[model samples]
Target: MMTPATIDPLHTPLCDLLGCEVPVLLAGMGGVARWELAAAVAEAGGYATLGMVREDPALIESEVTALRAATDRPFAVNLIPSATDPALLEAQIRCCLDLGIGAFSFFWDVMPEVIARVKQAGCLVLHQVGTRQAAAEAEQAGVDVLIVQGVEAGGHVHGREAGLDLAVGVHAVSRLPVVIAGGISTGDDLAAALRAGLDGVQCGTAFLATGESFAHDYHKTRVTAATGDDTVLTDVFVLNWPKGAAVRVIGNSVTDALDGRLFGHDPATLPRDAIAWDGDAPRLRFSTDSPLRTTTGDMEAMALFAGQGAGRINDIPPAGVRLRDMAEAARRILAQG
Candidate 1:
C-alpha cells in the first residue's frame, strides 16, 4: 500500500523493533489511551500505547489484560519515572512481561532497573526525550526508539523549546526510528516531519478528539472547537499536584488567574479536592489533584491538557475510523508522486 511519494517504507529501527505495521505511533495519551483506543490503533495497523503515568499496579494489569484481550496485535505501555513508585513499577513491569507487552515507553532517563527488566523481558524500549542532549543520552542508554517531544506537546513540556527541531534532533543522534510528537495533527504536518527525515509521527491532540478516547466528552468537544490561539503552555496547574511536574494546558479562568504566580502559585489556589461532576457522564476539567478527571470527561475549567495542534481539530470520530482515515490520506498523498 505504499506509494512513491509515500515514505511508508521509512520503517526505522523502532517500528522494526516493535513489529508495528506503520512507523506511526500513538503517543500514550495517559488515560486517553485506554484499552479501546489502544486496541483500535493496533487494529488499524499502528502501534498503540497505554500510558500508566498515574495508574495503580492492579489497574495497570487490568488495562493491559483488556488491551491484549481486545486485539492480538502488538501494543505498548508508557511508564512515567516520576509518577511510578519503584516497587509499584517493579510489579507493573512483571505484569507487562507476564502478559507479553510488545514495547515499553519510558518518560525519563533510562533507569537501570527499567532498562534491565524491559530488555530481559524482550520488549522494545521507546524512550522519550525533550532535548537533543537527552536524546543522545537515551541512545547511549540503548533505547530501541527515540521519541523527540517538543514544547508544543500536551502534558509535560520536558523543559525544551525546540518545536521545529524535534525530528532534526533525533536524526542527529541515534540510528533508531525517530518519532516526532507535540502539535502535530494533520497529514501535512506528518509529511513535513517525514520530509525532515523523521521515521514517523506520534500525535496526542488529534487522538484525544477521537470518540474512543476515554477523555471526557466536554474535553473532547472543547479540543475540537479550539482555535490556533486557544492553547497556552503553563506549568501553573501541574506544579500544584502532590507529585507535580510541568504540563501544557489550555488557558482558562482558573489558569488565567494563576498567571501572575506561574511558578510560585500555592497549591491552595487549585481545587482543594477533585471537582465534582454532577452527572454520570465524564467531566472534562483541569484537576491538579485528580489525574483521572483530567482525561475522562469533565471540561469545566479543569486542566484540559492539549497541544497547540488542538486548534486544528474540528471533529470527533472513533479511533479505528480516524487511524484508517489518516492512513488513507497519507497513502493518497504519497500516491501523488
Candidate 2:
C-alpha cells in the first residue's frame, strides 16, 4: 500500500510542509485568480496563491501589494513557464522576491537554474506535472512539492489522464508528496484522494463560486446551477491565449458553435444572441470573456471555467465557510474509516 494521508485540517504532510492549517489549496486560475480571492483563501486556513503570469510586471506587483494588504499569512505565486515568456517570468519572479513571497507554485517542468534561484532566495517551490516522467524530473530538480494536474481540471490541464489516475500513476514511480487538481469539489472527493495516497487537494471551480472571487455574478450563479456534464475541454481560444493546452469551460453558445472543432470558424460568423447591458448600451458576443468581474456579456455564453466535480457544488458562501465545510466533512469521513 501507499502512505496514509489525512484531511483533518489540523495537519497533513502538506500543512506541515506549507505551514497552513488545512491541506486544501486554491488553484491559481490566472486572470480569474485575483488578490481578493487569494487573500481570503489564505485567511481561511488553506494556502492561497497569486497567479503570477498573464499580466504585466506592474499588475503583478500591484496584486501582490493587494494580497499583502489583505492578509499576513503565507501564500504562493504560480507561474506557467511553458506559456509565460522567459524574460517576463524572470522579472515576475524577481518582483515576487522583492515582495517577500515565500512560496511559489510553478506549472510545467522545473528548470534547474530557475529552481536554484528561487530556492536560493528562500522560497519553497511546488512544481505542477502532468506525467510520471515530469514528476521524476521535478523531484530530481529538488521540487519541495508536486502538484498533479489531470485532464478533468478546469482552466488549463496538462495530463491526459484524470486526477486520480495521475496521482496513482505518479505515486507508483515517485515518493514526492502529491496534491491533486481537477474535478475536486467536495469532501468525498478529498477523502477519496487522500485514502488513495494523495497528500492534499487543490480545487479551483468550486472555490470560484465563493464570494471573494472576482468572477461576475452571472458566472458564479451559473456554476452553482451546473452539473458535471456542463463542462467541456477545448483549445478554441488559441488565438489570444495559449495554443494547445486544454481549457475546460462550461458549455455555452460559443462551445456549441465551435462544435468541438478548434479552428474552423471566422470571428465574424459567430451569432450575437447573448446580450448584456452597459447603461443604455447593449454588448453582444458569442464568447470573448475570461469570466472577470468586468465581463458584461451573457456570461453563460462566455468562457466559464469549471471542473467535472462542479456538479456537487450547490452554494455560494465565503471562502472560509467552504473550506471549513470541506475539511469537516473529510475529517468525519476519515474518522469512520
Candidate 3:
C-alpha cells in the first residue's frame, strides 16, 4: 500500500504519458533483471524493465505472463536487435503483444521494424543512445522516447560522454523526452537530472542491491563497499559474448588475472561452468555470466557489473521501499527548486 510519506505522486509530462507516479525507470539489465524485480519497481510506481539478454521466445512469453500475473501496473522489456535470431525476435515481440506488454526498449539503431510492429499493437518504443547523432537518428527512426546513456554505467555501456553532457548534447538537438542513464543512484541524482531538463532517469546499479534483485549477496556487498573509482571499463570479460564490449566492473581476482589482456581470446578456454570460491561459497565457471537469485560463490570475481555510483549503495532493501524513498526524496528536492 502506498503511504503519503513514501509515495509522492509527483507528476511530470513523462509520468503522465506512462501513468506512473515517479519519473524513473529501471534499466533492463541483461541476466540481472527478472520478474520479481520488475514487479516490485512497477508496484512502487516506477517503470520496471525485464532484461532480454537471456531471453528466448518461449521464455519471454512465460515471463510476460508471470509479470502480468504479478502486477497490473505498466511494465517494459529490453531488446537487442542483433543478439538473437530474427525469427525468434519477431516471435517474442508477438508473444509480448498477445500477453499485454505495451512497451519495448532497444539498445541500438532505434529498432525500426520493431517500432512499426509494436506501434501497430499500441505499444511505446524506447531507444537508448550514447551520442547526439544517434539520438537524432533514433528520433528520426520514430522512437517514442529517447534514453541517453553515459560512460559511467556498468555492463555493456555505449556512452562517449557523461550523463549531463550526453543529455545536454542530445537535448540540444532533439525534442524527444530524454531519460538520462549511468551514474544515477539517489533522489538528488534524479532531481539534478530533472532540473537539468531531462524527462526521467534509468538506473542499473542502484537496483542491484535491492532485495528483489537477482544479484548474489556478495555482489551486493561488493557494490556497497566499492568506491566510485573502484569501477573500470573493460572488454576482458566480453570473451565470446559481444566481442570487445566494454563492461564496467570492480576489479577482483578474475579481472586481475586477465591484467590488460582483453581481446583476441577464446572464452571457451576459461572453465565452462568452473567452480571457484570467494570464501566458503561455491562460485561457478568464470566463463559466461548471469545473476541468479540462488547466486553463490566467489561472485566478486564473476561478472558483477556495476556503475561508478555504486559507492552510494549501503543497504539491500525491497525495490518498492528503495524506489519509493528515492521518488519521494527527488520530488522534495525538485519541489524545493
For model 3, the stretches where C-alpha displacement exceeds 4 angstroms are 1-10, 261-288, 296-298
lDDT of 2 by residue, 1-337 (tens): 4345532433678888887888888988776678999988888889998776656779888998989899888888887766767788778888888888888888865577788789899899988888877888888988898889888887766777877998888877776788988899888888888888888999899889999888787778888998889988876543333445567778887688776684444444445554665445444553334566765646565567888888998899998888889888888888888
Tell me the TM-score of each prediction against the true structure: 0.86, 0.87, 0.88
lDDT of each: 0.72, 0.78, 0.78
Candidate 2, residue 311: lDDT? 90
Better of 1 and 3 by TM-score: 3
Q: Write the per-residue lDDT of candidate 3 for residues 1-337, one digit (tens) a residue.
A: 8775664435568887777778889899876688888999999988888987647767787777788899988877888776556787777777777777778888855566767888788888888888787788788877888999999987777765887888977887787889999989999898898888888999889998898887777778888888778887776675436555567887777777776774455455655554554345454544446446665555556777889889898888898898988887887896675
**lDDT-superior candidate, 1 or 2:** 2
Instruction: Tell how far residue 134 is off in model 2, in angstroms.
Output: 2.0
Question: Quick one: best TM-score, which candidate?
Answer: 3
What TM-score would you give candidate 3 relative to the actual structure? Answer: 0.88
Write down the worst ten-residue block by lDDT for model 3: 274-283
Model 2: pairs clashing at backbone N, Cα or C within 3 Å: none
**Model 1 residue 103 distance off true place after TM-score fit, in angstroms:** 1.4
Better of 2 and 3 by lDDT: 2
